[model samples]
Each structure stands twice: as structure tokens, then as C-alpha cells.
Target: MSVSDHAMPIGFLTCPGTHPGSPVRRDDAYEHDLQVDALRPALAALGHELVEIDWRSPVEAFADMPLVLVGTPWDYQDAERAFLDQLDTLEAAGHIVCNSSAVVRWNASKTYLRDLERRGVATIPTDWAQAPDISDILFAMEKFGNDTVVAKRQVGAGAEGQSIHHRAKLDPLWCMEQPAMLQPFLPQIQSDGEYSFLFVEAEFSHALRKRAAPGDYRVQSIYGGMEEPFEPSSADRAAAQAVIDAVPFDAPLYARIDMVRGSDGGLLVMEAELIEPFLYPTQGPRLGVMLATAIDRRLCQ
Candidate 1:
């Protein structure tokens, strides 16, 4: 496809800033992803234009674009209801969201793991409590039967509300009005690392292993985490495929299946990232071309 043949521009969403936003906080460790640089040239090669749009801005800002890819609105968790509402408005207004609004809303919270488990998809044992109290925390401990526990806000990222401690340190007063999910602190996250399978148009494209920084358990850059290319085993691919098969949407534009090996030596879903996950790697030949090709095909259809 030539530039002239590509008649539509892509709106790649980014974190929104405050009105005359404050300067970056000194202690803020957020590493803004630079996928745009790779995406622009790659998209241009496929004859599609790329534009960055603040997801916090009014939907009218980019509603005119043919495709609005939810690139990495990492802050959407801050105002989840409003964010999902915005997606509703965009889809209702005839804008095509790459992963679709339904998928976004469902994937917004970590509770999706429960749904996956019910559907027979292998998922790590997780227990959720709404506006939890002390009793709820205690129950999760007894239920998971683990000495150390990992508790996280239902809708959070970058280890924002993650607390790892012995059952004694858990404060039921922690999450106010917001729900939370609890899991056993899997040692493999530090030893074996988490496997992430990237899929485009529901087709597996690449895979990587994200390892947390030494002495840390959160595998995000903010926590000094690092990732390296990984080759998924046959069983690993099957596990990811099963997660894909559980999606209600026709065919997802993109997906990241994050999982780890449980004590019994089986892949268990750690978390499924269908909304705004950074899809490209820092070192490898980028996946932008594959993404651009997918976008082009969708447009032509």
C-alpha cells in the first residue's frame, strides 16, 4: 500500500496530563514507552498515518480517526468507570477500537481471572473481595493456604497497590471502596520469570520473559525489571491459545497472555493484558510492522 492509498490515520492513545500539567515528579519512576517512534515509520511503510492522542482528552479529539488503538493508556485505572464510558462513547460514535470496548471493560480489572477459571482456562488461584475488611483478608490467606501473600487493587498496574507480606501485616482497611485480589506469592516470578505471549489478530507473533529486578517482585520497568526474548514451549503456546479462545469478541486485534508455572508444573494465567499493553520489545526488531499490517488489513476489510 502506498501513502496515497492509505486514506486513514491511526490514533494511538497515551497517558493524559493535567491542565498545564505539573512537571515530572522527581520520585516518579514511570518510563514513558517509545513505541511511537517505531510505530510511525512502520505505519508509514504500510501507508497509514499515526497520531498520539491523550486518552484523558475528550473523545471528540480523535473520533475523526478511522482507527483508535488503545496503545498504552496506562493511567486509565485511575478513573476506570470514566475511561470505560469514554470507550462506550467512541464505539457508539462509530469509532473502531482495536480491542473493542467490551474487551476493554472486561479486562479493566484483574477479576477477569475468575471468569477465565470458570471457562476452564488455567488460571492461578485468586480470591477477590469488594471493599474488603479484615475478615476478607484472613479468608484469602486461609483459602490460598500460603505463608506469603500478594494483594493488589483489582484495577491497578506497576505494582501500584501491591502489598507482599505475611498474613500478619495485611490491613483490611487498605482498599477503601475499591475491590482487591489476592494470590500466593509465587517464587517462580523471581526465579523463572513471567512469560508474555504477544498476539496480533489473535495470531501468536512473539513471546518474552519478564524478570523482576533482583530483590524485587514487580516485573515492570518502574521496579527496575527487565525482559528478554523467550521461546514458548508447545504447551506454553497451547496455554495462550486457550486464553485467546475464551475471548467473547470475534478476533482480538491484540493480546498479551502473561503467565507463570505453578508448583505443579503447569502454566497458570498471571494476568491477561488486552487493554493498552506496551506491545513492542525494547531490543528486538519491533512488532510495529506486524501491527501496521494488521491495521491495514482491518481497514481494507
Candidate 2:
């Protein structure tokens, strides 16, 4: 209840220079770096210390801190096995990860899509294939029977491995060794755009409308896209909740739900970002305070 009672310093782990030679690439944009700078002062105002650490650091470095929040570690997600192994080791040794390793493992993969699908949540139909052949693509094309399709790497952000293709240009081997997820491209993304809703500790915070610039579906700033504030309708809020509830949240943290309405005009999950998502704090100025308070409350328990 008091500031002194909840003053354990919070450290944010991110990938600093994770990719040395490719600084200009989408993964190395320093979005997490900027968030650390923005949230620190706000957390400090609540008598909490905010620390930023490179994700590559050994587990012992974070053992002293009760909460080690993951910022952006794009590379970590790409090779999730190693990253998760490290977190598992830390947890085994009594270190704490905000949101916990359990949540991280579940939310890290797009495979969670199946879990949601089983729960009766309508999602873009996904097929996980590794180095699939032309026949594989053709089969998916027939199954979907949709005019357009999107092929994306199983693990990525900011649309790093997304490709839009018609039946004539279907290339299943495009993914190489990495597993890929295929989905019918929703035309609404080009017309109405995608909706990104931010949630801090299971509570709806705010939403943003991300429109691809011209002919892009990535909708990230790096791709020359734009974002505007949006207040989600109740249906949108319910959709966000449904996705969040599907994930087991053992620890307190913020989440971002990137979604688009399907052909039936029902919302479907694009991705559930728990690790590190651009909070757009500038759009929701009160977000930092809200996040700090949520951390304070959770830690005090």
C-alpha cells in the first residue's frame, strides 16, 4: 500500500545490438530502448526503480531483482528454444521473471493459435509447415480457396517474414528450415486496417488503428505505416479479453493484442504480444503510470 512497501527495483531486459551488422533492420529499431526511457521516470515517480539490461546477460545478473521484465528481444523469439532454456534455468535457480516462464513459453509461438481455435475463437486458419513443397502450398490454396494468402515465419515480429502470394506464385520452400504459418489474406486489412489493443494486467488500456502504407500489410512504422488512436467497441474489447484469458497469466504485465476483423466481420487474433510490444505510451500517456501501479501491486504480493 505504501511506496516503501513496494520499492523493489524493476529491470527491463532487451536486445541491445543483438544484431550487429543489421542495425537498420526492422528487429533492431530500438523500440524497447525508447520504452525503457519513457517508463523509467514514470515508475520512479511511484518510488520504484527501473533498470534496463541486455537479454544476453546470465541469469545470475538478474537474481537480485525480484522482477526482470523482458523488453524487445527479437532474436530471442526467433530462436525461442535457447531463450526459453535460459529462462527455465533462471527460474529453477529461484530467479523471477515477470509474467513467468510458463506464460512466456505458451505465448511465444503462433501454435497458440490452435489452442484458441479449439476454444471456439475464430482465427485465420493456420497451417504449420517446414520447408513445404509446392504441393503443400497448392493443398492449402484449395483448402482456403481464397484469392490471396499470407505466408509468415512461425516466430517473428513487425512482419519480418510475411509474404502475400496468389496460387500461381505459391512457393512452399520459401521458409527453408524455419517453420511457417499460412493463412488466407484478409482483404479487410487493406481496407479497414488492423486494430491493436493494449492491455495492462488484463485490463483494456487503449487501442490503435494501424494502416499499411499503400500496398503493405506489415503496418509497422518501419514500413512507412501510420498509427492513430482508437477506442474499441465492446465487441472489440470482448475479443481482446478472449485472447488474454486463453493465456495463463501467473505474473502481472502488459499485453498487446493485434487483430483484424475477418470476412464475417468478427475479430480474429493477429498476434498476442507479451514479451515486448510498442506501448504507444505517447498515445496513452497514463499507460506508464498504470503499468507501474500494476507492477507495484503484483510485487507486493
Give Cα-based local distance difference scores for all models.
0.77, 0.75
lDDT per residue, candidate 1, 144-212, as tens digits? 888787778888876786787677576656554678887788999999998888887778888888999
Error of 2 at 40 (Å): 1.3
lDDT of 2 by residue, 36-97 (tens): 66688777877888876667778778766777777666678556788888778767876567
What's the TM-score of each model vs. the native?
Answer: 0.87, 0.88
Summing lDDT over every window of 10 consecutive residues in candidate 1, give the lowest-scoring window.
Answer: 18-27
TM-score of 1: 0.87
Best by lDDT: 1
Model 2 Cα RMSD, Å? 3.1
Q: Quick one: best TM-score, which candidate?
A: 2
